[model samples]
Target: MGVCTSQNEAEKIENSEQDYQKLDFNRVSTYQKLENIANNIAAQQQIDTIFSSLIQRMIASRQSHILDMLEKMDSKKKQQFMTKLERIDFEFIDSLFHHCYKQDYPDVFSCNVVQSINSQEQNLDLIKKHKVGIVFLCGGRSSRLYDKLLSDIGLPSKKCVVQIMMERLKKVIMIASDNQEIVDYPIAIVLSDQNSEKFQMYLKGKRDFGFQSITFIFEKSLPVIDMKGQVVFEQENQAVMTPEGTGTIFLQLNSFINKFPNMEYIHFLGLDNLAGLPLDPQMLNLICKQKGDALCKVIETNSILDDRIFYFAKQFQTIKDQAKGIQENSQNLGQMCLNDLYLSVSFLNTLKQNHEKALKLNQRYHTIRRGNNIQFEKHIQDIIEVTDITILHQTDDFALLIDDARKAVIQLSNVHKRNLKLEGTQEKDLVEITPQMSYCRREDLKKIENATYPLII
Candidate 1:
């Protein structure tokens, strides 16, 4: 009789516990989730991160890309994104499409348009006096150009990219000096994994390029991982690889700047066009004199709608439809502008320290192709993301470069206005521009400073 009473009591206790749990099921689940989060936080606070294959891949694809993406996504979105991306095929696709370097850049960099300052000639002259150094981002893989066209005459000589770049810098020195004060400064070239060896060989004895010295800083190249997580092979022993973008610059800028202690400022330009000054003297002066760490020089450019006005917009206006202000603003790319950036050594160190976030400014990625052609690029225009940017629009004293119409084959040519100007692209370029689509040259600094022409940021 006592044993039966004990069993009944135990059953009652068990049933009571079950009834309590049923009554507060949602509360129990919430507590469990909170506990899991607490545990995750504790695990993350450990001295060293627990390494998984995915973490390893994140490190490989530039740690900042993963970190930035994480920061950008909220808790729920991050959980969903990460969980969905962890599967083998999905992770593989994510890795394959990682925004290492994309070129077409239909959607890239943007900034709040602020009121700009007048052209300061004193700034230009002061910066010019410091003997500023120049660096060109010239490390393209050349695979596209090669795939597009075969060797022309004899073993299809390496494209004249370096030659053309050197010629442009020579013009800059001439403008900055009466061919004298800004003489004998080294121009650093950031080479890709693909072009480092080739450039070293090509530039071996070439001093005709007019740079007192040319420095080659090679960027890292990582193998392309396919959807199966297997390395994509480019040739027998070589795996497919692409160059790390401007993040490379921010990471290595301090070290490179340290090497040239005499240089006060570094002028950076990408290889896509030779429109901006290799070293804009006024820009250097502004950067040197400003309380801020950096300066981004740009010019007023006609929007696509401005170009289309002659042909398409008139036709489209007949319809009752009108493009929204935001939509219309998208068409006006500040093409006449060449972002002539001037960075001080101190600022370079700051950029190096905060490189992960600063480089995020340049995180414009464009996915292309099934696998082989995914590309990523960071333009100098994106510098505003990392700094207190002071906007300087085109002035009459500044040279403006515009790509000429493709209707005819153009050998590189120059136009002399108030400032020296050069346009026309390489003979091997695939696309050409229309006259209506051209970037207009502005040689009206006097008018700009006098408020005759308002400065638009």
Candidate 2:
């Protein structure tokens, strides 16, 4: 009887332990599912760092929490928990890491020159000697200017903004050199699918821009759908959507690099800023002098209102994982922010560093979650200062002489009328015309001259 009783007690203890194990597993499984869902959402939103941190926290806490719960659960309840845990896939964590870290590995830099900047003269020479690539980002909708690239601004010749810009660029290149072969650089004008056909047609008959090769790449648009999967802009016959932000440029950059293996530099500018100064060889020479990989043009903003006229600098966070004895807090990645300055090479380097760091973090986390704890420290690259040219004022004669001459002519025309004597006695509208009129009238006689006519004998 004593032997039989001992045997029963041993059986009961074994069953109890098994039940506790099952309950612990169930809790872990549920937590894992919640984590996986969160990770998926993060990846879709491109919140890579946040997702990695959350996943690491959940996994680390899982084992301890499950073991604690086992100590309190009854045998029957424990078995139920085990069944629930069985439904959760342990392999999911591995899969999540892989999905989040796609393209996280660094690519080999095989190109002779990873980055190069050439002036209008040198650029011409470079294009002649090597394959060159150009990318024009045109993804913006005509929200501000009524969707017209060629709308007349009431000028006498009815020259549109884009037309004027193209003309000035052509003139600048002509002045740079007489070589016609410089047009060989492959120009890719990135446009949206909605505007692709229209843009292509616009470029079809116009042949004088002096570009030897031109290609248009259309960005894929995603439909704006609601939580129920219903399209938001269904009422409109055409799809209504927002243009994906400028981040898409990096993706298309690879293709540009691939096509032009010897590509030294790329110039990117906006469409509406028609007042852009000519691509001077001096500016290009400055860029080349610093060995700058990327260059951006900046115009000084004088007032609060002018701030909107300039693109603001971006701030990025540097993060390191804490679980692997790494620092996990966000730190400011670059230099102190400055006001009134335009974006330059330092700004571009910040962006490049942010991209590279994010990629490394993804790879590190991916390896870690797969039960491989390889310690990889993440660091942001330091940005070097390069030359920053304040875009000369539109009224500055050097820039005005080349591009804004027509606008200057309009100003001069108004001044000419203001100085004329009128028969009617009326308070002169000096407030509206005083400063420019007063200055022009005082200088007009001395400055204006007519060609001497040949005298008839």
Best by TM-score: 1
lDDT of each: 0.43, 0.38
Candidates in order, TM-scores: namely 0.51, 0.44
Clashes in model 2: which pairs?
Answer: 19-78, 22-82, 183-212
Task: Give the residue spans of candidate 1 off by over 4 A.
Answer: 1-131, 146-161, 174-186, 208-212, 225-231, 235-237, 285-292, 297-340, 352-373, 376-381, 390-457
Per-residue alpha-carbon lDDT of model 1 for 250-271, expressed as tens digits?
5566666776677766777754
lDDT of 2 by residue, 223-330 (tens): 332322222332312223434333345446556656666655555544434334334344455455654443444323332321112322222222232443433111
Worst 10 residues of 2 by lDDT: 375-384
Q: Whose lDDT is greatest here?
A: 1
